[model samples]
Target: MSTEKPRPTFQMDGHDVPFDEGQSILAAALAAGRYVPYLCYHPEFQPHGSCKVCTVKINGRTHASCTTPAHEGDVVESNVDELNDMRKGLVQFLFTEGNHFCPSCEASGNCTLQAVGYDLGMTSAHYSPLFPDRPLDASHPEVLLDFNRCILCELCVRASALVDKKSVFSLAGRGIQKHLVVNAESGKLADTELSVDDKAMSVCPVGVILRKRRGFQVPIGERKYDEHPIREVAVQKQKGE
Candidate 1:
């Protein structure tokens, strides 16, 4: 006779969703074909919960879904007006936090930030731009670092250290002063050992990192998020359906 324990189940919205033993709420939701909008919780990397865009109500209390574990009989609420409105506000804050001039950015149609903004129906940045005068780093002949569009998501940091096996990028400071830093004596990519083919090169979810001499190569309306919205792609990725 088999004596295996059954997988746990939870209530998301009005549906009974089953989850594996050690899966997070976000993981279970995505696995069950539910798309939870997230920024800092990529499946390839460990959950950081930095963006808090995946905030969902679990049993009438707020929790970061990517970090919170799923348990049996737990009630999870996502896609409600309250949570989505907060997501929109956070998206707008990310917009105003940097000089994300989308029209001029090379990552225009392919930017996750831009895609999420469109997904959330963000018409304009509700807050004023910080305009911090961050310098553009073009020290590398094959890459460019435009800090203006950086959302500080730290995808590059994770990819470099974990995927590429290079300790090249890291976050510095706290709160408003927080920013990405290259591990180099000259504080530049040219001085660092980062190559054009590194995983970190293509890991920026925004326009902060770009390959040199490759702008406008694909043109507008032909990008990844051009025809299909992020919601569709995200759902497809989650459910594998």
Candidate 2:
């Protein structure tokens, strides 16, 4: 068999991006320093577009950057007031659907969902709270599952499926009653293949799926929020640069 590697493709914002065989639009954009807001999409895991916060204008239509493929001559617009407003509205819906009390959350200062809310100027919840009563799963020794704080973004689900290759998490029910469930028979995370090293816990944007023994390990002023805007971080990570 041949051992040759493939070359990378390049594209500009105004020009249609020439996506190589397997490159995603998000990857191409960030490789070129283009800022695209995203959650539920980590380079380490497969893209899950459940967040709907990464919507961008591509050739005049809104498309989720995580799943959209780059094409030659496609005019991609990442920053638009209307698109930002849509993202803020979507995040607002997420906030109302769960108990995202920032002050009491272990992820408060370092949460990607919260950071994205702040970046999108979602300071208040305009929708009514769903207030679904959810049980906290603390059976696992390394992670905690507080379903109340979950936005159903599916980051954990994707990470568990794609990265861990075990598919340990999933959403059950629908609409207001939709909730995250563990793969184990007891519905607890304790006996699953999941562990502290699993990206499922770390990739969650809210306080829902959390590390049991590692909250506040970095201190208030030392977390990623203290270093740079999440948009910059997202771009950097997606580009792998």
> Model 2, stretches more than 4 Å misplaced?
1-21, 239-241
Off by over 4 Å in 1: 1-6, 239-241
* Cα lDDT, all candidates: 0.88, 0.77
Winner by TM-score: 1
Report the C-alpha lDDT of model 2 over 1-241, residue by residue, as the tens digit. Answer: 1248544443444543435656677777766667677767776666777777888877778888888877655677776788889988988888888887777778876788888887887779899887767779999887788888887878788888877898999989987778889998888788798977777767787788787777778777677766887878766765664
Candidate 2 local Cα displacement, residue 120, angstroms: 1.1
RMSD of each: 2.3, 3.6
lDDT of 1 by residue, 120-161 (tens): 888998888888878999999999999888788889999999
Worst 10 residues of 1 by lDDT: 1-10
Q: Model 1 clash pairs?
A: none
